[model samples]
Target: MKKVCLLLLSVLVFPLVSSAQENTEPIVLLISLDGFRYDYVARFQPENLSRFIATGVAAKSMMPSFPSKTFPNHYTIATGMKPEHHGLVDNSFYDPEKDQTYGIGKKELVQDGTWYGGTPLWVLAEQNNIKAASYFFVGSEADVQGIRPSYYYAYDGGVSNLTRVTEVFKWLELPQAERPRMITLYFSDMDDVGHRYGPNNEEQLSAALERLDRELGALFEGLKSIDMTINVIVVSDHGMADIPVDNFLNLNELTRNIPGRVVNNGALAHVYLENEKDKKKVIKALEKSAMPIHVTDVDHKENYQDLMYKDRIGDILIIPDRGYYLAWGSALPRIRQNAESLGTEVLGEHGFSPAYKDMHAIFYANGPAFKTGLEIETFQNIHVYPLICKILGLPIPEDIDGKLEVLEPILK
Candidate 1:
């Protein structure tokens, strides 16, 4: 009886002890340079980020999730789930069941927590008595899992990158008990420039690289001044590809014979039908269309490499060839208007299949825990969340799609 009682008690006690251990003490800093392609370090020679790569354990490239766009991949990095698993299936998408729309450009929709399904890192951190902070991450300001970080700054694009770096340093300067253990910083200049001027435009890309290098230089010095000893992990959501001015394939014109709409995100477009009955007509129209683009019906599952949620996409998915994008209807979203404009002539875009080299992202980590001067080959971005948890000494949550063992090779 005594042995049985002790065994029963152990079952109850062990879980609480384990749960408490999730509040780790180690500090971690995550920095995201949006649209910083894997090759940018070698191609543009950004001195500061390159120096971090040389001394740190870095990966050759990080393959982004399908629909390799900004919001999906960034949310994937935070939640450790593919966009399908996280319910952020696209940069902007409508849920058939929920009849709800989600997009990064919509501030009110972004703040609403109902759209987010998976538990993000910051929310998980707070559950374990750990204080976390974020400068301007996608889910930072949201009431995700009904919890925000101990410190968060509302996203303001007008704010300078230098200020974002200084803000992280300021957070670190707080009293140990009052400070956050995990923090995220972001910069979008690289993504902005890469899109405004085609990635192939070496002259403009060179100027953007100089600006990125200066920020990295400043961030490192600020951390040094604050005496914050922690792991610094840098990554880009996805890379960019060149989409020339003349490459616009107007889906409306080609599919004019069919009755449907194309919800486009510059690089990828999803077709929706006025009625389910029109699916056949839409597919037939696309099949015979003259546009040089890839088309797949969600019902015909065999052809797709990774279309996690078929219902989320339209009846006929339109994937424009490289150097091209889809345009539809009378008016387009303002975000894509400049890219489609003649005078703007913005050339770089990325929503290509993840298999394409142009969609690969950057990953680098430097800290006491990582092996120095180490370079790992290409890996999926999903594995990133587990590595961040390992650096913080926190347990990877059970529901996360990532595996801690996947990153064990580089850990000391």
Candidate 2:
């Protein structure tokens, strides 16, 4: 009877203990550098980045979740949930419920709240009554769970790296009483230069990295002058890869008369067919094309179970085989006409799988509260939220898919 009673008591006590562990207090500052790669930090010779990694805990790789595009991965990190769980599976996702498709560029569609459908960390923090702030993030402008951050900036493509950094510094400078409990910032230039010139293009990439480094230096300097107790986390969404001119596959040529819309993401394309039969026909045509593209319906999870689900993907998913690429509509013609045109003419692009090392990004943390000079090898972007929760002394959200590792083993 005594043993049984003790076991019953243990069952009753466990949940309360777990809930108690969720709430605590330390500030978290999160930064995401768009298209920033895992190896580029040290390889590009960025002094600021290198210093941060050396002085803080740098991961081997953040290992982005599937559909490895900017918008999905960004939300994935913010929410600490997989694309399947958080529901933003791609940069541009299809909504079957409303029978519509939405991309980041279409602000009107965003206003409808069809594209995003998860409790982003900022909103989660706000709901918990913790003050949160964001520089810019996908779906951040949209009010999720009716919880907007204490402060946030809208996403603007024209915003320069220097401007973004300066704005972040301004917020960090706020007095302790009014300061946000959490903050997020994003920069996109390095990823821009990298996709155009390839990671090996030292000229453009170096300049971009240098510019980012200087901006980072200024940010660090600002933080130094202000209270240094803030815990800063730097990360990236996905990596980049170069597709050769001869390797390009034109979907228009493959599916000349297929009834569907081609949404291309450089090496990847999503063919949204009007009907199931049309999708099958498109798939058959793509398979018989010059360069093989891995085609799949997002609803069929087996083919792309590792990356994302079919419904969240598209009717016909096109993944260029290895060194090849699938181009749609005018983009295919543009790529064929000029190999350099696709990248150099534009800028950078990322929205591939996270399996490749080149597509991985950096994850590092530094703060007075963090364990000093420690390394965390077994971690993912999902782990980010739990660590932030640890810092702020708050209860981790029940809806959050991320596991709390505390990452104390790496701290000095």
Candidate 3:
């Protein structure tokens, strides 16, 4: 009877064990070129990347989620969920429940697992007994859902692009049993330059594109030398918009009558009121402004219904039209006696409504599992997480807003 029971157990487990051994799925490389505008490839003439797009599937552009900030969008791609659904609504938001602020530079808050909702790609990979590594991708360093990628580096901007690629190649060289089949890398030079100088600055933007192209060339050559067949997904969180810094609506001046404050200053101005009854007064003040912007309340944002956590943001949302961004209240009066001392131009900014053309991001993929010469139309950035999960053969969590069917048009 013992022999019979043992035999039965073996029969039940044999297929799973063998399937795991024979799983020769194509290795996946997830990379993000921060603020890589879809037009940058053609605009800057990035030869290597341009050639790469020709050999694989390319999305005309990717529409980011509302607020369109970096942290929110990056987390969106990783979790296959919208920013509100994933609990990262914006780059800078105050969570009244936790009394915690999510900022770009706060390493501790970023590492805090409680702030993140849903399973990031790294954590998902770990759940499937898959080893993964991330170099500087947001949320990779955090312990999400009580698990992290088997091999993830701390998020650090000082790491150069060339070094990042070199490290990936080295990881790929490891023994099959020990190597991480999934990898994520990030490059922030483009975004950095876009923020420092407007996207329209031909000289600086061109230089940033060329530098990225050269680094990508080196990465491709290194992968070839190792003779590894890899599926590479290149994406960007969001694009840059030219904000005429000289012409920003001062929120303080506009909302003087209302007992509220402008909480955030950027493409979107978050307004919080001292009382619920003051909502009407605030809306009236913004409408009175001559600037070309659309102000929405918590009830009527562009995709307000789609957000699972709509209340995370302000009651009064300020979404500026293209070529405009908001300014902080203390910029002129508090800093200097004269408001005239305020700076003139803000080069570039994002976090505007995702509907703008400038906020459109880039998505290009080429590998064994993807069809060549396929160009997909613009889709929501949330849809990208499902594609990564499919390529890695990892289970897509049912709770995510990103659907695997959305990627059918691009799949081989």
Candidate 4:
């Protein structure tokens, strides 16, 4: 009888132990809705997003790093470092040391790991023996720190959003050991529509928002079938502002006499001088223009908060007012063509100073780890990295700019 009782106890206790072990590890799903503004929830009221806000913690806005463009801010969120520190100073920048230019369209340079700095979250996970997967996120394609996510796909905008959601579900369905503990997903629906139709176009913007929200609803519903505890975080790289076609400033025409190579990214431009002595001449010429703009030298540490890669920032920075866009003469024809195609003179853009509320992005999180119905104040996007590290029980690298204390209260 004693032997039979011991056997029964072992059978029952073994299953309990297995179950506990299977569910003990936490899972985090980080999602990015490109160009999602902070006030989008109140403005559009997408059904799924509204539900997400009510069920989890949210911020009035999430501040992006300077030059609030896609690549820099996305990588900043990943590595918890500013754009200057990460080496991706802008969407397109020239590295004097490498003597090469890095741009979004340049696949060769983008895939090279040497162009990036700071340890990405995926790298941290892989280094610590935790598995990570990314459907599409900046720096996921390039092997930062000589390591990429265990599972990832090269970015292809043609892939359907629903298909991406399906892939995430398949990742989660893997055997416990093979499943990734941290996963990142990206959607450009809002950004795409915003750029083409402008953010103020409610008809087009609302349609995009509704469709993306439905996909989020599907993702949330699919997680219900899984037994493990998972947390979902939704964030955006930056927001959008409308720019009138008449407001487009032709840099080539304005600064033809100025001696420098100007690389313009919509609302901001980096002026690289052929001679260091021309810095004053370039700034004076740029300032002489009657257009509403701010010209500052890269040496002004206050502008960028101590950039690690100052040379890449160029000798001077040119920023336009919120409703104005600075573009090269060569690109003006294309800009006009695009506006004509859309039948509107106004187009949406970002990459301006974050001081403008219009440049702020969104942050929303839901799952077992967050406190429900809690709304927090605006905070920097850099803090997101450490918060994610905390959720996965991973160690935060000392060099990162993010601090855990800022977001720790939201966690249970």
Candidate 5:
């Protein structure tokens, strides 16, 4: 009787063990919907995204990092580190040595290899002999640490959301062996529209989100048809906040004598002074500004230490309160392109500090590798990189700021 019981136990355990192994090796696909707010799906538009939320787990909000801009937040999401740790502070940053500003608009201004200092998930995938692909990301084109994803595309301002989605679908359709073990897809419409028109514009925001929803639906349905057990994680870089016209800060009046370049001038402005004396001058002038602008210098070394780097970032930084934006090049009749004018531009924008609820994005995970329907309470863009590594069964780099948790109730 004892021998019979042992054999029966083996019968049950063998299949379970084999199934676990099979499930552990499933594929991972990470999607970052740029400027996507957490509540847009449930509260505002109940379209395809609404359905997705019902099927997958979601957070009330995915809190973004300080300065909550594109480059810093995206790098935080991919590297699971803060802008302070990952080394990406904003879309355009002041390089003290070069005394010039760098932004995505000019590829030459970016020190791709140096800008991104941490190990991205794709790099970890490659280190573990797994394949990875990036459709678009902060440093996808930069030769960071002498490593690049197996497949990627440069950040193109002209590419439509539909076109970008279609390209990712095509890549997903590759043969089983050729398919990337990990893949990333980015959508920037919602953020684009929200910025120009503000999130309060229901009609325009809904329409833009619906378009992205259709693309997501198509991508999901296509993957399902392939019978692939792909783990899909959807996230956003940062949320958008309203920038009122009355809130625009005048830079020239504030920094008349500061010897530095103004890098970020829209919702936020970065000032890089030439020397310690210049930094002090800029700080004093900024504090006395009538618009109520918040000022931080490099010497603070605590809250503002995140802006410190060898030859990057300015000696002083200026962050505006919620309704204000600072601009360089002297304010013209029309400075930055309004996202609401979707006629010629994308639909959303994100660069404000991640303090308001509107600035929170979505974070969701679904796959055999994840705990199903688990709601994580403690999470940020920093945790994403380490989790991606775990999903691919790779080693988590020690340099990253995010730690691997069980993802709560997410895994089965």
Candidate 6:
């Protein structure tokens, strides 16, 4: 009788200890504000963002990976790998192995997990039995590593910012076991306005920033009402630069005779050659005609050694100088017409080398997990993945580029 009673007591005590451990794990909410430049706070001074920065840890600027485009940087933050390693080299890149192209506009391809490499944070969370939810991060819609967040919405730009915030509250209000320990939220307001009116357009850009700031204030207030420890981290994929209409480089006319396919991605272009011998000819033509643009063959192993799918990077890369837009055929004409109709000489663009200050994004964090009023120097965005994993007590994958030590100092 004594032995049986002891066994029953042990079982009950073990479960209670396990329950306490689970409940003590803090919740992390990762928010992305696309196209938010590093200097926007000093330029516009949005109230909520300002307060958040004042109270929590912030980097001077977050350096985006090379070819600082949307899809690549976001995926890099998600998996803690550079764009080349993650296999999403740009917003749109050609996969020679599959004989196909992947672009943000291609819905079927965007949702296909085969194109993405490395484990996204949501996938890591779910694999560890920690519930995760996403309101539309870059990789959230796809089933990465055969796993999707327990709660997620397909990418829908029409959804109101308030509605997304409301959904997050609903997710948090679930029972302890059902509530997600990790959540991702995204906002693209600044990106939209910046692209339309250019980053220097104070009136339109400030208005958008103010509106988003107000919504963030509301989100912060709502979080205070919850009893759990919730850490909020805000990041942006990349920044925007003003590209004048006169700065458009017509690559189509310049490389018309080249024996390869050129995929233009605004600030950068990728050239895939049909014949290996044609590489020299293609590079020569692009360099001669596109004077300001830089043309290089992909043979430089140091620059491409990390690429898991190197063929997707194309045989040659064409990078325009800062503030210059790379366009081909109808794109140039369409952009010209749009600029003419708008009466604006400048349109915003990115995908420049992160060396350009304007290509850097913002990083701010405030919550129980962070040290208040701490400011750090600029750090690469790749380090964020390990920081998030450390906060929630999730196991960090050994292969990620982000090191926990880099961001660990900011944690309380």
| lDDT, residue 313, model 5 | 58
- How would the candidate models be sorted by TM-score, starting from the highest? 6, 4, 1, 3, 5, 2
Please report how far candidate 2 places residue 169 from its true position, in Å.
Answer: 3.1
**TM-score of each predicted structure versus truth:** 0.87, 0.84, 0.86, 0.93, 0.85, 0.93
Give the Å error, residue 242, model 5: 1.5
Q: For model 3, how does the per-residue alpha-carbon lDDT over 1-412 read when each residue is reduced to its tens digit?
A: 3343234334433333333333355688988999887788878878778878898999999999877888889999999888889888887776667755567778888888888898998888888877888887878888888787877788878887766776776666566777787899999989988876768888878987877787786665445434455888899999998765565667566556767555566777667666878888778878878877777898665767776666567778877667766666667344233222434254667887777888889999987788999888999988888888888888889999888898866777
Question: Which regions of candidate 3 deviate over 4 angstroms?
Answer: 1-23, 255-262, 290-293, 300-302, 330-346
**Tens-digit lDDT string for candidate 6 (1-412):** 3343234334433343334333456899999999999999999988888998999999999999988999999999999999888889899989987989999989999899989999999999999999999999998889888899999999999999877887887777677889999999999999998998899999989989988888787777666556678899999999999999898877777677878888755878898899988888777777777347887778875877766778888799888777677787668888988988878899998999889999999999999889999999999999999999999888999988889999999998
Residues 274-374 of candidate 4 have per-residue lDDT tens digits of 89988887788788888888888877647566778888887888888778988888888899999998899899999988998989999999999999999
Q: Each candidate's root-mean-square deviation in Å?
A: 11.3, 12.1, 10.4, 8.0, 9.6, 9.2
Candidate 2 colliding pairs, count: 20
Q: What is candidate 2's TM-score against the reference? A: 0.84
> Could you tell me which 10 consecutive residues in candidate 3 have the lowest summed lDDT?
335-344
lDDT for position 128 in model 4: 89
By lDDT, rank the candidates, best first: 6, 4, 1, 3, 2, 5
lDDT of 3 at 314: 73
Minimum summed lDDT over a 10-residue window in model 2 is located at 15-24
Q: Could you tell me how far off, in angstroms, the CA of residue 266 lies in candidate 4 after the best superposition? A: 1.2
lDDT, residue 384, model 1: 86
lDDT per residue (tens digit) for residues 1-412 in model 5: 3343234334433333333323225688888887777778775765556666666767767888877787888888878777877777677776655555668687864536776778777777877787788888877778888888888888776787556655665555565567677887787887777766776678888877766777676656545444456888888877776655545567666666667666666656766655667666567767877776787665676765443353565566777776666755366225444432443222234566666777787897766666545466636778777777766778887877777773533655
lDDT of each: 0.77, 0.69, 0.77, 0.86, 0.68, 0.86
